[model samples]
Every structure is written in C-alpha cells, then in structure tokens.
Target: MSKNNTKSEGAEEEQPKGKTCFVIMPISDAEGYEPGHFKRVYEYIIKPACTKAGFTPVRADDIKKTNVIVIDILQRLLNSDMAICDLSSRNPNVLYELGVRQAFDMPVSFIKDEVTERIFDIQGFRDIPYNSSLRIDEVNKAVEDISENLKETFKSKGDDINSVIELLGITKAKLPDKVEISAETDLILKSINALSSRLSSLETKNVSFAAPKVVTNAANDISITFNAVDSVGQVVKVSDRVKHFKKGMGTVASIVSVGREIIVSIEFDSGDTGKYTNPVASVIKVINSDN
Candidate 1:
C-alpha cells in the first residue's frame, strides 16, 4: 500500500464518533443514604475532568431506564474508549462494573472519596482520590490530579493490564469486530423514543392503537440481548443462523436501541425479515418490562 493509503487506514481505525468515557459510579437511588453526594462528585469533579480530557462523559443517566440496566451498562463498558469508575462507598454494582472494565485493555481510571475504606484488591491501582466533604478546593485539586492520571492513561494506551485476563495469561479476549454500532444506534434510539412518545400521547388522547397499512405483515422484530450468550459468554449473533430461526437460531441483520431496550432485524431461510414499530418478545426470550 502507498504511504497515503496506510495513513488513511490508520485514520479509519480510530473510532469515528469521537471518544466516549463511561462513568461507573453509585447512584442515589441505589444507595439510599448518599443523597446528592454522588451527583455532586460527578457534577463538580468527574464529569468536568473527563470532558476536559476530550471525552464525551456518559453514565447510566444517558440511557433511558429499563429492566435491561445490566445490558446497557455492559454495552457501554465494552464500547467506550475510556472508563472512569468511582469506588466511593465500595458499592457492589460499581465494583462489579469496575471488574468488567478491568477485563478489557481500555483506558480506565478510578476515583474515590478519601474517606472510603481502601479496597484491598485494587490497592496497587492508581485512583483519583477526592475528599468526602467535597470542598471546592479539595475537589479542584482532585480534578487536577485526575487530569494527570488521564494523561498518563492515554499515553499508555491502556496496555497495562490489571484484571483476571492479564493475571491468568488469557490472550484471547472476545471483543467485537467493530464498535461503530454505538454511533448509529444513537440515532436509531432517538427515533424509537420519538415514536414511543407519540404513540403514548395518542393513547392519552383516546386514539385507537393502529398498525399502518403499509406494514410488512410477514416479518417480526427480534433482538439478540444479553440473555443470548454463547459458550464463551459472548452475545450470540442472531444473524448467524437464519435456517432455524423460529427454533431459536438467528442473528441480527440490524439493531436499534430505545431506552435500555434493543430491537434487531432478523431474516429467516424462508426469506422473511421482521421489522416493527415497537420491540417485542423474541423466539429466544421475552424482553423485560420497561418498568
């Protein structure tokens, strides 16, 4: 290949939707006692610092809530260029997420209030320590420190492995062939939400629910969700086996996310590909309620 071709290949390799920094932390509802404490940490410290470090900071709040919270978190954890996890209070969910991120060779930084007990397992790992009192000066200093941490992390390109994958000498981590789905799904998700809202509004206004006449009657929507995991624990591709689709073998030709829910298009050997205005239960498993 020519030098220009090599340069273009490298450019294309970069994740095209800018960088995403997944923020994993305890939410107020999860830990009843810490009302407003965690929120302040993100607002005054983490988010600002991560944003300054040239990342679009995202958290669970970015994805609309649904029963598929785990799926949403896992997807973000897998796809983000970097991660900032708050170990404050040592919340179980936060720690679980931190463990998941550790398995990947991605940029990950930890944050914690100085008051929280030292997590013995990750004692050697670097973290941006903040004061529990959250005083402005202390917070500012923490931000500066975290910025330096981020700089070092980016410089290292997350090559320093810190998880079981590294310790066990596991060489083949199952990462996706492409991570471009996140950017496209963002638009698809927005469209789904818009349509959902309009449908809800019509129901409130006493309009009868109606399927459009132009609908393709033969096809249905199927989503390959977290439940559809293969033996290595990777999500099973719904599009991989269209021959036995109804017998629970298929793959997603396309997919869209609405809130915490994902809808996928699947085609069968019989030549039917289902598309729908709203996602529904699949042959593999039923979707959890939005509640």
Candidate 2:
C-alpha cells in the first residue's frame, strides 16, 4: 500500500463553538483485528463521552445510502464543529481523509495507540495519547480530554468557513427546491429571505432577565464590536442576507472588524429613537467590552 510520504498543512479556519463532534476511525483494524473493540470505542467510549459533553457525536460507520461512496462521511466532517481521529492502526483510508482535512486546514484532534511509534509527524499539531488495552478508564479519559480540546479549537469556525466559501465564489448548498443552481438572483434572494426570518425570530425572544451584561454604549457613532448568535440563540452566525439583514432595520450596515468579535457601524433608525434603554445601539447583544 502506498503510504502518504508526508502530511499536508495549512492555516486552519476557526471552528464554530458547539457540542457537535465527528469521529473518523478505521473500522476494519481499529481494534487490531478484533470486532468488539470497534463497538467498545465507538459506543461506550466515544458516544457516551460526547453525549455527556452535550455534543452530538457523528460516526463514520453509521452512514446511510448515498450516490457517492462515503458521501455521508465527507458531509459530516465538513459540517461538524470538531472531529476526532484514531491513528492507532495506521489505516490508510483514515490517513488519507486526515490529509484532506489538513488540506482545508480543518482543526482535527488525533489519538493513537500507545504502542504505535510516531511513523510521521504532522506539522503544527499535537496528538492525544491512548493505549490499545481497551481499558474503560483509559478510554474515558482520552474521550473527555479530546472533547474538551475540541470545544476550545473549533468553537467559532462556522462563520469563517462561510466567509471563505463566499470569497472563493462558491455558494453554500441549501434546500433542494429552494435553491437555484444557475440563477444568482434567485439564490441570493432566497438566502436573504432565510436570514431575515431567522433574525426576526431572535428579536422577539428576550434574553435572560439576569443575562450576562452585554455591550453598553453612549449615543454616538462609536466603534462597536459584538458577538452575534443565530436564531436558536447559539453562538453560530448566519450569512443568509435576510438573517444577517441589510438595507433595513436590524441589518448589516458595514463590517468594521470581522474577526473574533464582529465590529460594525450600526445605524439606528427613527424607530430606535428614544428606545435608549441602552444607547449606541446595535441589534444584537454585546458579548464583550472590547467594542
């Protein structure tokens, strides 16, 4: 078998902060030619830990039918907030897929059998240590550590991915009937509509009465930076124009600074007049004082 001579590297995109997890492991030899090990690692170790961390763990072997081979696997990897890989058996398929992710600069967490010496080093990354003994405590600790690491690494890349896709001039896929393959007008229009609905829903809902103090400002055209969330009140951001809003109330005015905390010059309208419950207003709550 032709092994990859070297690993790929790139600047990784920021990860969206969430509890979703993806596991990429070699099913054929994960347990060293043993059947039960696969189930044990995936079910008892991976699944339970992810669930306990409040993450929805996605497994490769659980995929359903698709027109392309492993289409589901690829989809989950791209969609997940974080991913874990088992390099213990040195599975070529797993390594190749890992290479692909590295090509995209995706933040991936790795684990390997303690017995397996480092065949090759991955540039600018670390590996989580594990053993093949199938000890419950060992597996549990590895899983917990990996999950926490993921929470830190890929916590906000969701927006970064969308921005990169847009810069590359590729549109994100949407609902089949709602999406227009060739019509730029229809595609943007639908995206805008979707975004608008999402934003509107967020406005109607109230934050916790004792919600953490967000950005507060004086009535002036001052610089503003804030963390925005999706309709579900999650840290995830939406780019569908309507959801992002533009040209009207609760819309994108112009991005000032677009990293970590989005800095924008928000224009308050007449409706916002005397609505100075808090001045220097923006539609979204401020998550920090850095603005």
Give the best candidate by lDDT.
1
Ten-residue region with minimum lDDT total, candidate 2: 235-244
lDDT (Cα, tens digit) per residue for candidate 2, span 1-291: 112324235655443435577787777645445766666667766676566655788877775542233656776776676677777677788877775565455556666678766645452245667657768788778778766655554543442331223335555444244533468866765676677667766678653322212333365333432222332232211221212222343333443333334444334443331112222223444332322
* Candidate 2 segments exceeding 4 Å error: 1-19, 30-33, 156-291
lDDT of 1: 0.63
Reference-based TM-score, model 1:
0.53
lDDT of 1 by residue, 128-241 (tens): 788878888998898888866765565455355545456557763677776565877878777776777776665556222222112122355333323222211113233444
Judge candidate 2 at residue 267 and give its lDDT. 43
- Candidates in order have lDDT scores of 0.63, 0.53
Model 2, CA-based lDDT = 0.53
What lDDT score is found at residue 234 in candidate 1? 19
